[model samples]
Target: MARILIVDDAKFMRMTLTNILTKANHVVVGEGENGKEAIRLFRELDPDIVTMDITMPEMSGLDAVKEIRNEFSDAKIIMCSAMGQQKMVVEAIEAGAKDFIVKPFDENRVIDAINRVLG
Candidate 1:
C-alpha cells in the first residue's frame, strides 16, 4: 500500500474516503478540504498518490492537477469525477493524471484504479 492524500470539499466525502483507504491497508497521509489545501498538502506531505475531487472552492481539481503536474511531474494523481464528466476526465488525463475514480465511489473500483495506477 502507498501513502495517499484525499482531497474533497465535502467533509463526509473526505472522511468516507479516508476510512475506506485506511481500512484497505493504505496509509492516508493527509486530507484536503479544497484544491488550495490539497496543493499545499501535496508538497508538505509528499504522499505517493492523490485522490482529488473535481469541484471545490477556490481552485478546481483540474487547476490543481495542472499545478501539481507542473511541479511534481512524476506525481501519481487519481482524479475524482462524477458521471457524465467524460470531457473533464479526458482533460484530467491530458493534464497528467494517472487515472480517475467516479463519484459515490465503488470500493472495488477505487481499489482497482489505485492498484492499476500504482503498478
Candidate 2:
C-alpha cells in the first residue's frame, strides 16, 4: 500500500478521495486545502504519491507539482481536474504529475491510477 497525500480546496473532495484510497488499502498520510499546504505536506510526509487539485486559493496544483518535482525529482503526483479542465490537466502533466483523475471520481479509475503510478 502506498502512503498518499490529498490536496483539494473542497473538503468533500478530500474526504471522497480519502475513502477511496483507504478502501483500496492505501494509507493517507495527510490532507491539504491548497497548493501551499501540498508543498509543505510533501516535505513533512514524503508520501508515495500526491493527488492535487488543479485550482486553489494560494497556489495552483500545476505550480505545486513543479515545485515539488524540482526538489524531489522522483516525486509522484496525480492531478485532479473537473470535467472540461482538459487544458489545465495537460499542463499539469507537463508540470510533472504522473497521472490524473477527473472529478466525481470513479473508484476503479482512481485505484488504477494509484496502481499505475506506484507501479
Candidate 3:
C-alpha cells in the first residue's frame, strides 16, 4: 500500500507496471516518460517508492537516481532493467536503489520487489 512512481520510456511498459502495481493495491502516485520528469514528479509527489528504467531518453535512470538520492538520502527506489545489465544494476544499487527488477516483468516479482523495498 505504498505510494509509487513509475519511470519508463515505453508506453506499454508503463501501462504494464501501472496495472500490476495498481492491482496489488499500491497507489501509483505518478508515471513519467523520462528521468527529468521522473525527478520533478518524485519531488512534487513524494511517493514512498519509485521504479526507474535503466535506459531512457533525456536522463538515464542512474543519473536520476543520483540526483534524487542527492536530495533525498532516504528515498526508496527500485531499478528496473532488461536482462543482462549487470554493471548498470550494480551502479544503481550503489546509488541507493533498494532493489532491482528484471523486465518483461512478472507480476509476482514486481509486487515482491515493492514489498521488499518498502520494508
CA RMSD of all predictions: 0.8, 0.5, 0.6
| Cα lDDT of model 2 by residue, 1-119, tens digit | 99999999999999999999999999999999999999999999999999999999899998999999999999999999999999999988998899999999999999999999998
The alpha-carbon deviation from the true structure for residue 68 of candidate 2, after best TM-score superposition, in angstroms, is 0.5
What does candidate 1's lDDT look like per residue over 1-119, in tens digits? 99999999999888878888888899999989788998999999999999999889999998999999999999999999888998988998999999999988888889898899889
TM match of model 1 to true structure: 0.96
Better of 2 and 3 by TM-score: 2
Instruction: Compare the candidates by TM-score and give the number of the best one.
Output: 2
Poorly placed runs, candidate 1 (over 4 Å) = none
- Which consecutive 10 residues in model 3 have the weakest lDDT in total? 110-119
How should the candidates be ordered by TM-score, best one leading? 2, 3, 1
Query: Which parts of model 3 are misplaced by more than 4 Å?
Result: none
List TM-score per model, in order: 0.96, 0.98, 0.98
User: What lDDT would candidate 2 get against the real structure?
Assistant: 0.96
Instruction: Report, for every candidate in turn, its global Cα lDDT versus the true structure.
Output: 0.91, 0.96, 0.94
